[model samples]
Target: MSLIYEARSSSSLLVAGVARGLTTQGGRLVRPAENCWHMVVVRQGGEASMRLVGPWTGAGVASYGEGAEILWIRFRLGTFMPGQPVTGLRDQETLLPAATGHSVWLNDAAWPLPGIDDVDAFVERLRRAGVLTHDPLVQDLLHEPGSGLAPRTERHRLLRATGLPLRHIRQVERAQQAAALLGQGVPIPETMFRLGYFDQPHLTRALRRWVGHTPGQLLRAGEEHLPLRTRPLDAPSLH
Candidate 1:
């Protein structure tokens, strides 16, 4: 895995107690097969695809529109009750999913979901409605937990325990161009093109979701520090 992870989350009024973070490409993340939930607003570029290799879930191996890039608007969901067969994604622009109360699942797409465009405005509108709230863990994550992500030693247990899927196991096979161009502080449009994303908006949205911060915001945040694995954007990927 060679992705640069910058986790920043602010309290918004839409998702109440939920927090958002950003993760940049360069590494790998492997998710388990359990009945978990996620509200993911993701974007894709190049030949990227997301899949779920498990049983007892909704769709698996979901491929988006084949463009150089694709943007996403998603959310993390949990079980409202003890056992409800995980189902399809939400199609409308409503802030009822998080408000309805579920479990905390990130990047796992086995529950209510929407597209990049659909949930984009919805998040903004919900902020106006005083719905989501930022989480407080952003500060420590900003330090880039030197230990890395939590290891899933109990996949079978969690699968037997939850029934959906675990967080998508991110495998850092490609260095999506965002890390490259953004490293130079280039305008998002050029970076977007370099990353194969459809446009600036798509790139920006992904930056916010995975990395928990925008491209420029990340650059600014790192102005006073250096990463343990820091290297130039033009450098070759480490995977």
Candidate 2:
């Protein structure tokens, strides 16, 4: 069975999607978005039976499983592969960017990257570091998602300093804090108290506006990408 494993974009410099346990017959996808830079990883889970269908068409795909459950992951950096066209043009394209608060599907020619080996191995380094799955609350931010995303197109002046749009930095930071807290399974009521919201409703509004979903939705999205791990909630002082 072929399916998208997970998809999500945080208020950070990363946007990601993953697929696992695809059918032996390799699948194709046409992406119609301008991803400044990103990585694509392919991991072998079981029954190494798949192949790329276009562009570098007929190229022999790497084999994983049996001898070893091969995990392949691709890394695409915004600065590195600036607007690299998606090659293996397919018929279906269904992806949406979480930030920018807008989404579009391309009817134009979509070029996707060719094949590769184990996607998991690429992430193994992050796994070992206390960084990957290390922070639980990164996803349960207490502020608004829309607050930061609306003004953060790389075309801004102030955003460059804060690494995010200044018009919405404070809100994004708060939401980031809340996301971190939620990942630890911290109760929402208590989080509201800690974040100084008038009530759950107030926080809920912020969550919806800034993050594109409720706190629970943020956590689920993170979980779908990878199991969130816990850590000390030493958020920076709100000076």
Off by more than 4 A, model 1: 13-28, 33-36, 43-86, 89-239
RMSD of 1: 17.0
Clashes of 2: 43
1-239 per-residue lDDT for model 1 (tens digits):
22232222223222222222223433233221222233333334422222222221222123223222222222223221122223322211212223212222222322333332244455564334443333222222323442243535344333332333334322111122454456556666676665577766776665544334466764564432122233442444322
Highest TM-score scorer: 2
TM-score of 2: 0.32
Task: Give TM per candidate.
Answer: 0.23, 0.32
Candidate 2's displacement at residue 202, Å, is 2.4
**lDDT of all the models against the reference?**
0.34, 0.34
Candidate 2 residues 126-162, lDDT tens each?
A: 3344222221122222233432433434323222211
RMSD values for the candidates in order, in angstroms, are 17.0, 15.5
